[model samples]
Target: MDNIAGSKSSLTWAVHISVALLVALWLFPTVGLFVSSFRTADQIATSGWWSSLSEQESQNPFIRVSGDQVQEGDLYVIEGQLFPETDAEVSAWGTSSREPEAYEPGAVVDLGDGQSLMVNEAGAFRMTSETDMEGTRLPRVFTTATTPPEFTLENYEQVLGGGNGTDSMAQAFISTLTVTIPATVIPIVVAAFAAYALAWMDFPGRALLVAFVVGLLVVPLQLALIPLLKLHLGIGIGKGYLGVWLAHTGFGLPLAIYLLRNYMVGLPRDIIENARVDGATEFQIFTKIILPLSFPALASFAIFQFLWTWNDLLVAKVFLIDATGQTTVMTAKIIELLGTRGGNWEILATAAFVSIIVPLIVFFAMQKYLVRGLLAGSVK
Candidate 1:
């Protein structure tokens, strides 16, 4: 019964449930981060990102009272709003820190010095004193208020270096693209030629080389960094775009060659034989026939290489970043921001999303090829 054609598996529902859980786990944080990138700092601190769409009730920090005074009767008066111009409604307020919500909005309190203060529902406050209140320190007001949902592009402006001229995420964004594009392209170019040679043409030690490439896929990347950096320094590659590109290419190549080789091996053997019989040279066959046919494999490797290189910090740190700070990547820039703007979640969230945006685009655009390419040659 279980082996019948098109029979359903007993565990299909379990698999579906597991998959749904995994997808939700991945999607929720991504959505939260995206939403958080547009939120204000206070909004982020006060409530979870999921709560951002509805009215939020929160306890605002102490706001020192300030305003010009107007004389009404024998009392001098100072009036102002607690919050900035917004639709915030004060539900409760207090004059002291310990009793932040002791008084309801619109209640008047006697301060016992022939002065009184009133805080209203719309976050407005008025203080009256028989004596002049000018040049004297004013009481701080703590309020609990409900505010409508808020979002802004100013976080992006600060992160992208539009708000302040001092931010370096913009420069870092360009530098990361500089490193990642070449690193991705160079490995795919190198690996395709190598894969075709291993998959098709007869060559000495070919089996050994294929096994070597497969073995390298399991090697810890950290094990190679120090030695590779030393070799680079000795050879005058130094620390720059060239060095980082080379570093990523080297780290990326083993899997690249392995994947492309597997996929190429599964390509119809007769096509190559026919092309060769028709007098097509090796280079011509590779460029015209092999590359075009092997696009899924190439695309898969390109996606992996691009994501790895774009997010890499250790390799960039060891092989590229110098004392001058000229070649910093997005990952490194975000770390620097962590030290400097750590308290500013809005800026941090915006920068984090910006860094992943390109990788997300690359993955989704080529994701159709990823599974197909990886599963190539598995059955055979």
Candidate 2:
């Protein structure tokens, strides 16, 4: 009892730690980029957008009417100043466009007309006119507002419109789908047929073919890229959607077949034999008996192939690098954006999230099948 309890405790701890680590690892960059993407360029440069909600102070420039002050009970007062107190820089000054800030703040200077003015650091000024100088105006004050920081979704909007980055990922996303979906589907279609044959059919070279496919599983895709590209070119296919789909299908087929065959071979021989005795042809048995029993395997392989093709950059780059630039995928477009718009956090975050969304949905939708498929034929 104690041993079982201890094992349970250890397992619970392991799960808790794993969940915590995964959440932290995934959330850190995603949250940072999300906050940064909404920040303005200046704000992003000055300080972290995570400080957007904090209070800030800056200097504001304003003009004060020096003559507007009146003597009230032996008190001299001036209401306005030429600058607001805070953190701000003075860029340009103009006093008749000739003598800007001729007299610094806190200086009492004469205007050479029986008029004197006192300017303070707070931008307030007091002017004692010889005779209530009517119709006289004060000099205009100019100051820059040193805004703290701000965030906006303009980067995301521009990226979605394909105007902010090298190549718009939104278009590339569709193109990727155009390539990935077919690439994923074709391999499964072809591999399912091959798997059924290898599992049930009696052929002389069947063992050799299965071994060859398994051997092909270890062949690095990078090693085959150039040869495959040349093959596509030589076949007059050039680089296009079809080429990418075929390339992914060919590359993804071995594992697809191997996995499906393993699961298919595990199915009860009694069921297959009974189907054959029932006058069901091999094709009908495969379509009806074997196919239904192979759902778990199919779903598992579909998830793997879909995710692999979706995230692929190199194959898409090699097989779809055409002159028209019409064959680019999301990964390639995101690469281009990294080079051109590296500072665009909104674009990066939105693109990252967009790319992840499909895979996540695929995983959740087929998770049950993944487990079931892995266990298929193993029990019997």
Candidate 3:
């Protein structure tokens, strides 16, 4: 008994550790991206997002002291604040580039010509000379300061159309929505009808049709892109939302039908047969009985199709986007940003996070249904 209890305790610990590790593996990058989206370009460049949450010593660029001289008791004084916001604590200061942290904060440094400079911990500096200061170019000061963690919404603002609205993904976001909603909805509607027929109605060659759909699931979607594109062009649809919607519906239909049909097949046939025997029309039975009972399956397929359409770049590029680039979706916009604003981590992170937010919302909202449908449809 003692040995068995010890083994059980060890097994429980192993399971807990494995779960924790898996959660961290999945969460680390997502949390990093979320943190990076709020950071400034400078902050992202200088340090990692994980380190951004704590105060860290950083070498600041040369900050020039204003040449504007104030007269004080026959001495010329040049005073200025190095950091406007004073959010950082100055640890050291220097007058030359070679020795950026030559002097500690609050210590005065002499410049040999009856000139001296002092910088306090608050980043306030005062430079005084016996003679009037010369030249329009001000003396540069460097400092090592400990900056607190900082976050900004400017990246989000820029990506969402705040600055100039030129590089914004707002239009693409709308365009993606335009593509995803209909593509997700139409496929589920069509597939639900077809699925009900395949599951319940004993039509001729129904088994062959079901087998064909299941076979199509293994077929690669890439092989169909060019052929479908030609077909669309030949049919006067050309390249637009209509073409993309149809393409997504075609690609998504097989899985949707398969999932919903299997789920509906497993459902108690007595309820459906009873409805049929009670003088109910086929449409009425499907609408009132099958539709309500198949909510989990419908929701599962909706989430699947929604996410697939939302994240799809190749299909959108091939079928929807044109030379005008006006109908570009969020995924394609991120690709454009990869080429154009590649160096801008904040922009990339914000764009990526924005693209994922909708799918995540859909998943969380319908997760229960998704799990239910999977469990219900699983082979017992």
Candidate 4:
């Protein structure tokens, strides 16, 4: 008994540790992206996102002092904050390029010609010289400072149509919504009818039709793109929202039908038959009974189709986006940003996060239905 109890305890601990590891592995990158989106480009370039939440030591190069000098009796003085409008403490300061941290904060250093500079811990600096500070070029001060964690909404604002008008994902966001809603709704509407027919109605070749749809699930979607595009062009639908909607509906139908049919089939058959025996017409029974009971299945398929349609770039490129470039979607826009603003990680992270937010919202909103469908299917 003792041995068995010890083994069980060990196994439970191992399982807990494994789960924790898996969760961390999946969560780290998502958290990193979320953090990176709020950081400036320079901060992101200099430090990892994991360090963004903590104060960090940084070396600043050639921060220029204001050229405006005030006279104090016999000496000319320049007084200013090293980092304006920031919460930072300078640990060390220097006046030359080679030795950036040569002087400790509050220590006065003298140049050969009676010029002296002092930097305080609060990043305030004072320069006094017998001669007036000359020329348009101001003196540069280099410092090592400790900066508190900083975050901003500027990246998100810029990516979502608030910045310099170009390269914003606002248009793409709208286009994705336009593509996803119709694509998800149309397929669910069509697939629900097909699923009900497959699940409950007695028709010839029923098994064969189910098998055909299952076969379609295995067929690569890439195979249909060319032929479908050609057909769309031939039939005068020709590369637009309508063509993309039709393509998504066709692609999404088989899986939706299969999922809904399986769920509908598992439902108690007595209710359906009793409703039919009560003189309820087939359409009435379907509308009033099956549709209501199959909410979980419908919700599951809607979430699936919405996510797929929203994230798809290849299909949008082939069917929706034309030479005019007006119908671009979020995924396509991210790809464009990669090519054009590849170095701008703040923009990229913000754009990617913006694209991800909708699917996450939909998933969470419909999660109860999704979980119910999955559990119902598994238990039986």
- TM-score of each model, paired residue for residue: 0.89, 0.69, 0.91, 0.90
Q: Where does candidate 3 clash, by residue pair?
A: none
What is the RMSD, in Å, between candidate 2 and the native fold over all Cα? 8.3
Q: Model 3 reaches what TM-score against the true structure?
A: 0.91
Give, for candidate 1, the lowest lDDT window spanning 10 residues. 371-380
Better TM-score candidate (2, 3): 3
**C-alpha RMSD of candidate 3:** 2.5
lDDT (Cα, 0-100) at 306 in candidate 1:
79
The sequence of per-residue lDDT tens digits that candidate 2 reaches over residues 316-361 is 8888867677677778877876887687655676676667778778
TM-score, candidate number 4: 0.90
lDDT of 3 by residue, 1-380 (tens): 33685588878888899999999999999999999999988788889888988886788888888847889999999888888874889999898999998999999888878888999998999999998787745568998998888889989889897576557889989999999999999999999999999999998999999989888987888998899999999999999999999999999998899999998998998998898899999999999999999888898888788889999999999999999998999999999989988888999999999999988898888888777766754434
In order, what lDDT does every prediction score?
0.88, 0.72, 0.89, 0.88
TM-score of candidate 1 to 2 decimals: 0.89
Model 2: lowest-lDDT 10 consecutive positions: 85-94
Angstrom error of the Cα, residue 363, model 1: value is 1.6
lDDT of 1 by residue, 53-109 (tens): 999999999999899999998989999888866789999999999999999889999
